[model samples]
Target chain A: MQRRIVLDLDLCCGCRSCEAACKAAFKGEARIRHGDIAGAAYLPLACKHCKQPLCLASCPVEAITKDEKTGLVIRSAMVCIGCKSCAFACPFGVIDAPLVRHISQKCSLCADREGGPRCVAACSSGALQWLSDDEIKRHEIGMRMVSKDLFFRRKA
Target chain B: MKNINPKAITIKKALCPFCSYGCEFGVIYDDFGIKGVEYAKDGSSGGRLCPRGSAAAMYLNHPRRLAVPMKDGKPVAWAKMKKDLTKVFGSPKSTAVTFDRNVTPEEYAAIIGFCEKVGIENIASTYFEPESHLEPFLDESFDVSNLQKTQLVVILGDPFNQTPMVSQAIIDWKLKDRKNGLIVIDSLHTHTAGFADQFLRVNVGTEPLLLFALAQKNFEGIDATKVTGIDRAIIKDVSRRIKDSKNSIVFACLSFGHTYDPALCAEGISELEGYGRMKIVPLVEFAGYEGNKGFGSIMEMAKKKKIKYLVNFGELFPFYYPQVAPDLKNLEMYATSTLKHSGYTMVPVPLTLEKEGTVYTSFGKKKLLGGIEPPSGARSIEEIIGPLSGGSGKGKQLSVPDHKLDIKERARRISEATLVKGKGLRLMGEKIAFNFLGFFEEASLKMNPADAMELNIASNDIVKVTSKQGVEHMTVRLTEDVSQGVVTVPAETPGARKLFEYDIDTDLRSVNFIPTEVKICREE
Candidate 1:
């Protein structure tokens, strides 16, 4: 089963514990970013690992690849040239070219480790969850059902 | 830096000293210092921690940590430093010691004993505020676990920002039982307010007035809409909810840096308890172990008598209230035992993870801290103060006096006092948890979206906030969370302290007041 990280914005407190933990785990590079949005809401942004990965298509040296097993968009530093094409092309803005490293870095979802991303583990609130595509679909359906029930109950 | 052997990993149990909630976490370490902190399923926290507790390991071995004692900006021998301290505080009666509340009970006892032996009556903790006169009504023994059983939970102030664990517990309760009522009463629309079943955005200092209105059950006379910025319908609904609930818990967030009459709030809770079983849990943000061990008494003595010399254990004074620095400087000599250089006769102390002793939690429970020895040349408070006092006696327990409030008289006083009104904006201050080298750097002013628009100010724009006392410049963060007339700044920021007006509450015998008025403008 393919795994993905899901962030429920409603439960996120914007404490940035995930960012701190990710940075610590990834040698000072935070794979996730958290910031406030309009209407006093906070959001955490990370790589979506899309089916049509823009970063993979935009890389000049074909440095970015998609993992078929995990469905994670993996960026390889070994094959990448010091070019900014992929960083610019990614819609999520999760990729960055560090001045010190000269290579682009992004969230790898902690695929090499046991368990999932450190960001998920570090989340104090149960806002960040690791789930398969089927689980995500079920979660969405469950949330929709709850909202519908509440709406009908209020109307009644 | 030394290479850590992953094979030699050891888990050491300790309490997080960042805040007073005193959540215990297991420190993962190898041959090197603290590698990481793992949540320990114990204590009031129930195996949960905020970002501060999780990131404590990074702070423990921070590059700028002081490892040795210094004199006049130069490293000094421990023996020489002791000699200098003896000279400065030759007559113990003329000397006073002020410290942070993170002190272990043993250290606090030793310090008190030492002060007593030296004929010194002046001892104070940074956390020492005059115990609220409203202490009698506050239920000190209210268990945190009882939140789960409560049908209604009323949270005053943002515990989600101040004490995350407590807020998490409330959230958990609400999530588990959809029928449970969670009411958040705050001046601003705090993050926790989003989760509330009912959010009452009360005016800044009118918290006491609203509470008073609730306590007296006289909703008729008071214009609830004008006074509290809450509609009368909502007020009646909340009152009915409180009246009907079998078990209700009110969690009051103390130490929010903004003052509201806690006594009046307590009185309201007491009134609600009359209708049914109600528990009032005061959530103080800082650990007051020093305050628990006779620090309040020492403060009382200091006010009555003149203290010639003041020696501070840790960087407590500046962190507590920078205004106290002038009074400390007035003393014949001032010294500090701190983790960083404070340009005084400095004695280095170990970080919480590097020392071993018991620390008091905000809940008044004692927990063990530190399993490893302090860095060489550094010492714990007990080690220094213990030897100085000749180890004669243990410290006295905290004596919280029970003062009965005349609710009628307090209501009269509340009505008589001028409410915050004018062209200026309301100033609110909050204590942000994230810090580096024990100093808060993320100081910014939060403005309401409407206010920001009226002033032609945008997010990240530097703005000038002018209170009666002084003016400060801070970056603007516009959000709809705050009301139209208020601006909130982090209380620990450099210039935020000067904005507050200090009034000695004769009844409470404490010098604390929330400054409510300020004029905001965009900086060109």
Candidate 2:
């Protein structure tokens, strides 16, 4: 029952449209808070939903927890302060400073929405996707067999 | 200075007429005209600019803007201007006319009919790609993100500081690591050169001579001392330096000075060229040189099969020929360009900044520019071509095939597809992003403290930078920070280089040409 975000590395043209769209969805209500140039390169990461949850341990107030049914890490922003201990505790730099708000934040598995992560929805190259853990494993096996070298050899 | 009056300035939202950087600026003005300029924080440039943008007001406020069209030698009113335009070919036939700068959208439509009636074969709208249409074909892969994997980067004649986004990229590249070190080869010391790990200073015009010298050492001959300024010891040092690098890149802008022997330059670097590990990126001043080459070559292939009249709307022809300034004929040509000139003819573009248009080419699509609407009765190059080739009634319809997709969206798709396939890297595959390309186009790169030298030229000294056309002269700026042999002048000025003499006899050369011959002399 575990869920995952599928990535098609080859299909990713690296437009960063998803990054902009995601920033806009949360922050565009007032104004774009991030003063950094709009198109600058970014690594938009999400949690792997590890078996040993770091968020659960790092949260002193117990504001962060994992959903056993879907394996999605959930965060209660209402109880959280702006202290960034959770951001530091997460091994994968998935936590982003939310726009113009005084609270720690990370992807809550797009909990309010019906679809998957908004980043996947806005990706122009179809490089991002949400899938069940079983589906991800099957796809990974096929991808590994089709191209032995996705990250190492080819340089363009 | 204390007596000068200050004027209230207005921040105009107009896009920069330079390259795709699209920087915006505030124009300080009064009854006296445009006074000065500052970067527009809210505009495309995001409040930062190169020297050119900082000084745009000078060029635009220059006294010599063409207030009226000059037919032959007489300045006429708008009424007569249109009549003359109509008389040029009688009725709308098949003829194309390129404009200098600034034409309204409506006027653009009118000119199309003029070209069609005049029987213009093919109209090349320079307005569509001011610095030559290199934008539309750009993919997200060309964005700065690709620099993560970039190893060895090379910049030729272009100095990134002279341009905008490219300079920012250079600063970013430095933040990443010296792991992605830089190599710059040029006649003069450029801002791009200052940032390089290795700098190759070649004699002017003899850029080819230096390249040939390198090739000779690698293969045919070894007498490097006789061929170039660099001695055998230096060549060996340079050769070893290049050989040691795995992902080496060699690039040149060929704008400021000359690298006449690009083929030789390519061959010299060819020693380091490969499909993946090593590559050459050309830094071009004009936009769309590569894309235009692709389309033009294709059209040529079709021409061989008896195809006639290519209705080029969103395309530009590659200026394959080396950059050369227009020859100042019997009538003394005067211009103010980035390269100041002196002597026989007057250089104008360099002396003052003009309200120029911007050029954009992203994902292989080209957009010339937008500015204060051209004065009534004026025409744009696109308008001239549309009517000539049977364009839509008002020239409002884009020449793109009927699909209704936005040009920007289409261009993005094209860029994405090409990048995903990664096949188009064929012109020596080491993926050259926009910043890297900017590094190559502006050959005079950043220079280091030790490597840098103050040019002999001094401030206000009338010096001429020449090409085949003529020589242009301007007030010289002598800063020790500028690397020697590298002349740093603002390109924003259109004809600033017309003050210099060509040969002390007839003035018929300009500094606009690549590899221009320059001679500095004190005013008598």
Candidate 3:
């Protein structure tokens, strides 16, 4: 089953636990990036795992690819040529360019762990959730801002 | 065949010692060594770990983990160190014994036993962080279930960043009811303050004044509104609501250099707690223990050159607080530490994480399993103080000096102190678990956009901050969270910590690292 990690901006308190988990697992390079909306709301961004991956297309050595079985974006360290192309081509700006050993850092959704991404698992608040496409539809992620009180999520 | 793999992996459980939450997780080890930490779903806090808890594996397997004694950046033999210490102990009258964090309750008792045998009368605690003043508030056991049932919650500082494990509980409770009231009082706009129904932004180092005002305690000459920048009616109104609320809690988490007087801040909490008839829960990295004599006595002796040798237990003391280094002239130091430092006689010792003992937490005392051994050559307190062999005594509840608080004098001083002079900025300190004692990343300075614009500094630009006591260089981050004429930094490292000024309050006879006045300019 295909899955994705989604962050609820309303619940995030800008504590940066997701990024710390990534940095702890990997040496110091955080694959999951942290961004804030003008110091108001914390936004934890991850790989979209797009159908047509831009990082795979930009890779000169064909190191970046998608696994057909799991529909997961994979970055192979052995085949990677340490080129900067993949870091630049990512539209979401999730890929970190200046990584240790000059290799492009990408999230594999914690391929070895059975649960899910370490970022989602280590989230201090229940802001980050691993959901299937069907489960994602159920949340209707931005329902509060669209239908309910726009200010409610901003406060409370 | 699955269980017959040559490199078998073993998982051992341990508690995080970074904060008072005392979270449990699993440490994975193979034939080579530690791999990483595993989230324990059945453990407390529902397997949720903060940045500090997640950094446990790295902290254990860090390259700088000291395995042997070091002197002047070089390894020293244990026998040589013992001989030097023994000779220094010849004059026990001039030798002082102190302890700080990273010490278990058992280790503290052992230290006291060692002091008695060695005739070292100058006993004091060197862990002088402002959070130490909040130790009394942790007496009441706070249940996580209480967050959901309480109608009103008052927070003193930013617990979201300091103790992230508790964020979900508070957040879940606030979302459950629209009528729930959350009040935050802080000097700067913090993440927790953003979610508050009322954010009372007080003047720097004047938190005690506002808190006292909330309790309806007044100083005859001091105007609280003029000093704290908070409206008097709002303070009264919030106090009334808290007094009338059927169920409420006052959660306090203090930061270093954030207040002018820490003990006084605790007094304010006491007053508010009495007025509201509510329970208090203080969240801190460590619930510190005090010594027979205050640390001020040691400083006074050092200034007069009456002390010759100073022996400190645990990691933080003199290394973390270099501002007090000048007073100890010609005083040779012997300190037990987990990491190596530039100067001082560094004895390799086991951190509390690697030792089996009980530590005080927000809820209660919890035992450490000591599943992992200390690095090679690192000795326990039992071995270091072996000559004075005695059974470790019970963990004594040491109390801070609770003398009569002179409200008028303190209030007047704080009111006048917060009046920032023109072209000067007040430097405040805050605690961040992600910074992790500056072991992972360098400390950054947060400045108001207006101040940054005036200094011609931008984000990511280096700035030099100079105070009367010391100077520091840090990367600048401009934000409106901080008001104008104020700059804040996570004073986690030695360099950042050295910049702040300290005070030895004559009333309580305790040391307090208060916010300092500084001039900031873009570094060329």
* Index of the highest-lDDT prediction: 3
Tens-digit per-residue lDDT, B1-524, candidate 3? 34565468888888887777888888888877898888887778777899888888887888888899988889989898878777776788999888888888888887776667667778888988888878877774578788876899999999998888888888778766767888999998888887787889898888898889998898888888989999878988998998888768888888888889887788888998988887788888887778877888888888888998898998887789888888775688999998777788899998777899798778899989678877988988878776534444333545555578786788888888876464578899888777877756688999998888877899999989898788888999888888888999886556787889898987877789988889888888
Two-chain DockQ for each candidate model: 0.29, 0.01, 0.56
Look at candidate 2 and tell me the lDDT of residue B219.
27
lDDT of 3 at B229: 91
Best by TM-score: 3
Candidate with more favorable, higher lDDT: 2 or 3: 3
The local distance difference test score of model 1 is: 0.64
Which DockQ-derived CAPRI band holds candidate 1?
A: acceptable
> Against the hidden reference, what TM-scores do the models get?
0.85, 0.46, 0.95
Task: Compose the digit string of candidate 2's lDDT tens values, residues B276-330.
Answer: 2444443433343221122222223333532222222221111111121221121
Query: How much TM-score does chain B earn in each model?
Result: 0.84, 0.55, 0.95
All candidates: TM-score of chain A: 0.86, 0.76, 0.90
In candidate 3, stretches whose alpha carbon ends up further than 4 angstroms from where it belongs are A140-156, B1-7, B389-397, B420-422
Global lDDT of each model?
Answer: 0.64, 0.40, 0.83
Order by DockQ, highest first: 3, 1, 2
C-alpha lDDT of candidate 2 relative to the true structure: 0.40
Clash number for each model: 0, 139, 0
Q: Return the top candidate by DockQ.
A: 3
